[model samples]
Target chain A: MSKLSKKQKWLVAGLLAVALCFGISPVTGAMHIMEGYLPMGFCILWYVISIPFVVWGFIQLKKSIDANRRNMAIIAMCGAFIFIISSLKIPSVTGSCSHMTGTGLGALLFGPAAVSVLSVIVLLFQAILLAHGGLTTLGANTFSMGIAGPFLSFGIYMLGKKFNFNKKVTVFVACFLGDLFTYCVTALQLALAYPSELGGYSASFVKFLGVFAPTQIPLAIIEGILSVIVIIALESYAKPEMRSLGFIEQEA
Target chain B: MVIHWLWVLPFVLLLIGGLIYKAYRHRGEHHHHHGFGHKHGEATIAVDTYAYHSGIAHWNPAFKVVLSIVLLLFCVISDSVEVSLIIICFTTFVTVVLGDLSFHHYFEMLTIPLVFLIVGSVIILINFSWTPMTNVILCLPVFNFFVIITHDSLYVTVHLWARAFGALSAMYMMSLSTMSNEIFSVLRKAHVPALLIELMNMIYRNIFIMADTQNRMRNAAESRLGYVDYRTSLKSFGSTISNLFIVSLKRSGHLFDAMEARCYDGELLFLETEKPLNAKLILMALGVVAYCVLVWVMTRGV
Candidate 1:
């Protein structure tokens, strides 16, 4: 077998990290697409949709490990990072609080494919151990927060970097937008399952968006700031580690 | 308008806060057994601790999973709330009897999802509209609106809630009785690809180590008054988190070294515990299937 390239390795590591995050303790995110929230058919459909992505993630992971065993620790670290950082709850607003997904940072650092898998692991553990997310709706949750959020974050980050935006500003915007869009995707998912009589899917989506806005807007801002600060802190304090993880090039 | 939107917040938050408080107290009370991870999450202990028992714990993981999943499916697929509610009662009885867990503790754990079901049901109950419809549950002054709960909506809400409760009960039965690793073995048995399983095991092992590291770091920061105010808290949180990431990367490096020293193959290996099948096991399996049938029969037409 041929050795995988650096980009391939990251892709592999991210997929493996999904399985890794699945192993984390179940101190989960609050009120995730909880169990039984979606109907039976919806749940099954979601599992079907998500399982392919999850399997692809693991396949990528196996290839990575077979190519190089040392990548195991890197995979573990990314998984741990997803678990702990996303678990951190900053006060979202007044009455309610939402957790920073840590997806923005993970996506920017790891790529969306890896983050997609990692998010599933995080959501799975959240559903199982913490009882925050639902086991049945894992697919829908994975699609929304896992696949969608990271893709947006990665997309935005790439675009910003390509446009020669300041690294710090790019990180902030990516994280902020990533956080906002996670809720947006979540709203869409929820609406899809339970469309309102008032306006059907679009209206229900808007309603969920409205409901999430008060909390998620503050959360987006908090998450954005947090990601930027973390990036800066790592760049300043752990330059070598960042370089090791390929999160940064050779230190300035 | 504001009152209707915001009313559920206090209620939900209070329930959540109470859960946290209870977990905190329970952790302090039982810290000797759990060590540091209890503070971060008590549900880990509360729900999973019973799985170690030898009662139904000795049963086949695949069979147990099938049984639970079937029950869960019934709960969801069934049209009758009566059937779902009956399922809730049945699973509750089995879980308590077979698992030998406290009824109070079991019910307490169940309440969190019950609360979620209530909050989610609210969305089903109300839609923003000017016209008042039949079966209005509450005519609130919010958005010049009333909660229009017709018979059909009521039936759906109650049915969904019951299904949720029933499915949860079924889940509790499986989770409470089977060790997590056993569940992993079931995944393995189901031929869920070796790479994913190994990776999951690796990550699962690492969760404890990360928790230990994070717990120590958090304590150190707390001692330094890192969370004294909101602003300081954010700054401190940012630094601590980044520090943890750096530390995690380093830890993984060390872990890789250790694995290499152990002649680490990528494969994770664990011996599955074996228990001889007996009539009791058969009876339990039969009883569960029978119980399921009985449930459908009793509440089918309702």
Candidate 2:
């Protein structure tokens, strides 16, 4: 490395100040790959990757729908819960609030594949009805929020169960990691699409992570806490409803 | 070389302005003393209301979907600044003028996506290097690495921003003019899996009811001083969501009972208003495709 001249030092200081300003700044946008953000090739690739999971979800849904008359209404209710959760403002430390991804809770309740199907519909609603996300980027968003996050969350919950962890601790960790993983996957998607000329994809990945992950950290913790509280509340007041929904096992 | 760096100033300014404006608006909306009445409810319902009331909502929904997708594909694939600009203006014209959406509403919706666009593009504009280069516009050294904004990165940022904004406008046009129920019906007619369509219809039906329940619960919490502090707010929000979940479960059970009373089957049949695809709509779609091709051809090398 070359020695920094006086001018270079000034430039460095100025830029650091700017970067710091942005670092602490509140996030105003929801976390979705905006329309046309990805190139055509990447968009197609994500759709290809996400389709199988969504299809599997569809098959599972069909089975359940076929098994019972009320399945459709129950699934639809879960999907609606997703929409409401996303719209609810989870107050952040920065004063400006962020929307919870809400997939983790759905995953915890109905399992991952089921949430994937519901998430695609909810994503479509968000794209068209809210103008927050977009049509072209739906596949990418679905993969992150719907598939990857939920699958890991479901897996972690299972793991927590097998390891005989506290139920509340399990719920909190599962939800928190699920939320965090969604942002990581989003950053990865962006980095793959727009790699930097200097240091390539890895560097681009770090930069994207730097931009998004910090803001998401607190939100993830809050989501975990919120999920735990909801689970506790449900166990206390709606045990029979939970059992009917098949989240809790029915007694012999 | 330094003068070339000035091009990034407007983006930086716009970003800062948006942040300040967002923070200002957020503060304006949430008064801690009042505790709970805010504008969150209106936003969720805003775009849908516009779609239902749009001037051309009665048009064949499938045609509108096709037109927007075609235009969107062109915008994304062409990656030409001029073509993107044309698409943006054209779609905005369709949405605000012909579709009769208010200019204010259109612009407000546009800004939501623009937040992500601006952030992503700006990130792409920045480059990291281990050693200093000659073409660096702005450089910062963190440890041994130099974080710099380069000319090429700036060019990419502008191009990406334009392309994204163009596709977004096209999507907005389709969304603003076409109701989602109509789109679902169109999908059903197009033979998308029957299961998916039924689920969508049901979900669409449930969303309003849940949102209303949520709003009421939130109001109840506010009155009880549930959100007076951070911890209380968390507890309140959690219970509110828990209540919403329980309510949804009960409501679904009730809905099933009501459906059973009507001798219902598994499938849901929606009565759609038939809108014919007229010659005018086809001609207009063809016109858009032709315009896109013309712009593509003209801007080939640029």
Candidate number with greatest DockQ: 2
Tens digits of per-residue lDDT for model 1, A1-252? 234467766764575355223311121234267677778788888778777776776667666767777777788678767876766555433423346788778988877777777677677666665556666778888877777778899998999878999999999999998887878877777788878765689877886676556556777798898888788898898877677657776756
lDDT, candidate 2, B1-302, per-residue tens? 44433433443454455445545555645433312122555665676778888878888899998889988988888886666766776777677666766555677676556755665677898787787777567776667777788888888888898889988888988888888888888788789998888888888888889988988999899999998998898889999999999988999999989988888776777688889999987987797678668756755664
- In model 2, pairs of residues that clash are none
Which runs in model 2 stand beyond 4 Å of their true positions? A1-29, B1-38, B140-145
In order, the TM-score of chain B in each prediction is: 0.78, 0.83
- Please give the lDDT score at residue A239 for candidate 1: 76
Q: Which stretches of candidate 1 lie over 4 Å from their true place?
A: A1-31, A91-97, A250-252, B1-39, B53-55, B134-143, B294-302
- Highest lDDT against the true fold, candidate: 2
CAPRI band for model 2: medium
lDDT (10s digit) by residue, model 1, range B1-302? 33332322433454445455555545645333323132333345455666776357877777777777777777777644655655565566556655555556667667656666666666666566666554455433233444345555566677777777777787777877777787788888889777666656666666666767776877798899987777877888888788888887888888888877877777666788885556776686576556556655654543
